[model samples]
Target: MTVLVPGIEGRSACTEERLLIVGLGLIGGSLAAALRSSGFNGQIVACDPNADEVALGKEMGLIDSGGTELAELLENVSMAVLAVPVLAMESVMKTLAGSLSAAAPNVVITDVGSTKATVRECAEAVFGCVPSNMVLGHPIAGSEKSGVSAANPSLYLNHKVILTPEPDVLLDALVRVKTLWQACGAEVLQMSVERHDQVLARTSHLPHLLAFSLVDTLARQDERLDIFRYAAGGFRDFTRIAGSDPVMWRDIFIANRDAVLSSLDDFEAGLARLRQAIECGDSDALIATFDRASHARHYFDTLLNKTSYQAEYHMQPHGKVTYRVRPGGQAQGRLRVPGDKSMSHRSIMLGALAEGVTEVKGFLEGEDSLATLQAFREMGVAIEGPHQGRVTIHGVGMHGLKPPAGPLYVGNSGTAMRLFAGLLAGQAFDSELTGDESLTKRPMGRVADPLRLMGVAIDTAEGGRPPLKIHGGAALKGIDYDMPMASAQVKSCLLLAGMYAEGETRVREPAPTRDHTERMLNGFGYPVSREGDTCWLQGGGKLTAGTIDVPSDISSATFFLVAAAITPGADITLEHVGINPTRIGVINILTLMGADLTLENEREVGGEPVADIRIRYAPLNGIDIPVEQVPLAIDEFPALFIAAANARGTTRLRGAEELRVKESDRIQAMADGLATLGVEHTVVEDGIDIIGNGNDQVPSYGGGRIDSLGDHRIAMAFAIAALRAGDDIIIEDCANVATSFPDFVALVQRIGMSINVGGDNV
Candidate 1:
């Protein structure tokens, strides 16, 4: 069945296949043209009622054959594309079913119909049942022009093609359809059949309807001729779609009646508000509306261009971010970083799980915490504001969560995805958790394996990575689990699941991890007790709504602390930083290294200890790291490694195997960066050993290019290392620093650090 379909630019589609395209119009003809141009060598047989269009398609070499006869093309045809008008789809489907049933029993049928619900129903009526090979799709791309002459081979390039494949659709058929669209350079996306219909009705049908109505109304005016003659570009642009095929639009309106009407009602209500504003001369209302629209438009453009400020800001070619830092600058400032990220995430999750509304202050507005907030909103929680570090969560109670429409995408937050696995495991509906590239590469097995022991069915990607798909309603039973590693994320995940399991759940960590989850649970009125290294909680306990005030993150403050310690004449103060007893390994280790650090104005805030930390520059002396402090400062090791590189003697660290599984291998990452900077270091499987000349010796820490490997902590650590660098240090892929510290560059500049950030456009 293979046939050479001639194309433009001396190209030809070379796919050894056959396709029957019914309707030689814009959509069908363009698809045929695009397929050929995309090098899909296939037999393309086109059918149309109009003889002229058939002749033009053949003349254009867009098809191997063109005719009015449908049965002739049905033979040996494995797939058919029905691209006719909406109201004519049923009739076409009926004809195909009756004719192709005998000739090609396995032919896969698909349509480029804008509305899918009616087409699916029409298909069911005509064929007695919509066959499993039938896939419904719509290409969200077109022009006002119609007919074969308007066909363009590049029409679908970079456009969206949505497939509304039913659950029963054959997997092979769906893949084939997706492949064909992709061959034409269209980005194929999937959605439910009903969702497709509703989305198109609002985004497409109603807009066209408005265009036609506006044009028609203007045409009927008394001064119509003058209005048309003097109309500006805005008027013409707004009503451009009014020039589209009238019959096709008319059928679309009738087919998608309810959804279009609903959208129209909403639009009319908005219009009425605008009308009232004009009549009342409410300048404030008019300005507010325009401002909101303008702001939204700009935000959409940013998303479309993948240049949003919060995420992926400073992306470069090949997905790398380069940071240039000048050496020998002291850091001296009095400021606080964002709120503790761990506490911010728990505030949203616990608030959403509680029985009533919960108010939280000092929420980290960083991308990681915001990702968790967005995930809760996706699950039907009414959340308001992280406005200036304040968030209000309308709790849905422990069992009151609606299933998310799709997987919860917790971007760059391993903590969010890990904890959510346990929280979602007890739900009545299934849920899948996904994350950014960095998180997807990190290990999820630690959490998944333990949750499986609790009788939850969880599936991980290859090599124990995400997206983690957790099946719902497992009749989970509490287990006395001993953690293989000292990870707070894994411990929190199990503890959250314990809240819904039968009987009591206890988790024992070999070493102490962060107790934020345990303490936060207690704050939410859920009883949790800690005895030594084991934390236990009872099942069927409800979390009560409460206020949370998150202190500035000590992890973020670590960069500044190290910056001040390594640079001479440096005196910096960090205010309102969390100094949770179990999480102050950074302070303890720095003190042990003989850093000039002091904790001032220490007090308790929202059940967590907070303090103002002031650090003065002092010559550091490296020592063998106490293995007991590894778990306490596991996340801060990257920054600590920077301090060790500037210390007076050899710094040996061991028994910190957990550092290998973070956003990046912190041990290896620091080792590689230190090597590039001409620092002496030894990398082992568990820890790193570094020999330093100390700050007074003008140590041999010459700067060279270092790759951060998309690790935020590694990037910031190197940025701080520039203080002791003999030359300019260049760090790559530092954009991810925004995940925890969005204002790192600005704050560092305010203190005497010289940093230059370069993005893709730069």
Candidate 2:
């Protein structure tokens, strides 16, 4: 009764031992053809009741042998593929079980059933229990045509095949089943039996049933021919699955009756609501429903990769997302924001330019920093991820990088383009840097002009704009240049180019900016000296790789710092925040405004001072922000403006003209938003003066829509304003928040802010 087969080593690697397909229909025939195409030279025996079907399969060479008896095929078969209809599978399973005994049992059986529960139950009944060798799987792919004649060899390519295995299923059996599906170009996924059935009922079974019913009902009409003839492409597409095999679908509906019925009831309830809306002529209700459905439809198309939308425009129809934020919530508990974006960008750049491997921790995974990481990868440098704020960059050393195949795209990162300009200028190969719409409009002439002055050939768009093209192999000589303004980005740019210049390059700034670049360069074993506002570095120096521990961005921490300072009874601690002297203007300004802010647990992390900043609710009195702190807190002004709006008396700020050329015109954008919220404000070219409501308890913060102008900080600032707003504030164009704080929405909601996405999900 027991049949023995050859062992694994006895067969060639290119061949399966023995495979028996129980049904020679479309699925079974396709499996045979796919296996043969994949170099499985094993014997493929098929069984079909129709003689003609078996003869056609043999003629097509889909199967080497054919028969109508399942008993004969079971002997010496290594695996059995049950591709039969649900009703016929029970008898076939019983026959296969009766043909095999426990003496030499090694065959692994699997089914390609659309539904799993019923077929698994039949297997258990025949074998006294579901066999450990049986693995239940369903391919989430199909075709309208049926039979061996219509079989396609590439039917399962790029399609998902889900397996529902029991807890005690044999591991070897599962592995073999997965390998077979993968060999046919199917991505196999595993889940529980109950979950698989429940998911398929909603996603697949219900849709098929609706298609069949709708097509059948329409065909019964008196004008059926005319209706179909005049039908548009949409109607034909909706009813396309109605042409599937009737018997197969009928069995699926019966076998999955419980889940299918539950889904049908839920769908019918929604359909009744739609019907009522039409009967009562509710225009507003109809529009709201259609809008929600349209959004979902577009999102689904994007998931399926069937849409023509660009990456930037994928989040919203017009690249805008409005967050409806309600007032009154105090920030509480300890939180650490994302890693410092500036440090993150520099780590990748310097690490790529250094010698040997450079391991980094506390790297920012935000979009802007990630864009810089991807740019280096576009060049010939090998870099590992920002996996949980850690990155491993295998350094290519100075003059070791290959020319990029095409233009390097740094999305929404001005720091990347400017710094890359200097770094690429030293390279012997030509390079071009481009960015998203926002970065392309930013002024890059500052970096380009300075590089050109150093005897480097550089070109830019009209008016010193982006798409910076750096000509290769230019002899460069270092020179001492006094920066027209204080910009850490511009200073770092020339410093990087100076590394390969003919002599020492010294950059003097009028005002101080973030010193992350200088500190990180030192950490990389590259020596430099700083005197007051001037920093000098020598040319022809090699950087040895080292570790970098980037602290949490103080710029991102400013939002929560302002949030707690403005809201009543609020107390929150920002842990491990960077307190660099150049970037601590926000801390100084908030403290000067009479906020109950304190720094504790101060220590250094990777050459930057970091501490847990604790802030409690305190009445804030406005004052003229020190002109010296302008460059230091430049990036935090958007959030700082909200704090100014809530403080008593008027807060005057000056000497911040540098904010104009950022991701957006920060001053004007914030001014427009504050005006909508009933805040009194005056905007000058270099500064803004806001007259607060004079009541710290309840400021005159009203509800209105604020456009972020594609700026991440602006969007987050208004979201925090809801803490003191009288009503809901809608902030638009907030999708760019990923450039800095990707977790802004989740973190704010966790801290008790009544935020809703599109008037839902409170």
Measured against the true structure, the TM-scores of the candidates, in listed sequence, are 0.74, 0.61
Worst 10 residues of 1 by lDDT: 1-10
lDDT of candidate 2 over 527-584, digit per residue (tens): 8889999998999999999888888999999999999988888898998999999999
Model 1 residue 596 CA deviation in Å: 0.5
Q: How far in Å is the alpha carbon of 166 misplaced in model 1?
A: 15
Most accurate candidate by lDDT: 1
Report the CA-based lDDT of candidate 2 relative to the real structure.
0.85
lDDT of candidates 1 onward, in order: 0.86, 0.85
Candidate 1, which segments miss by more than 4 Å at Cα? Answer: 4-139, 143-157, 161-245, 252-309, 312-320, 697-700, 760-762
Q: What are the RMSDs of all candidates, in order? A: 7.5, 23.9
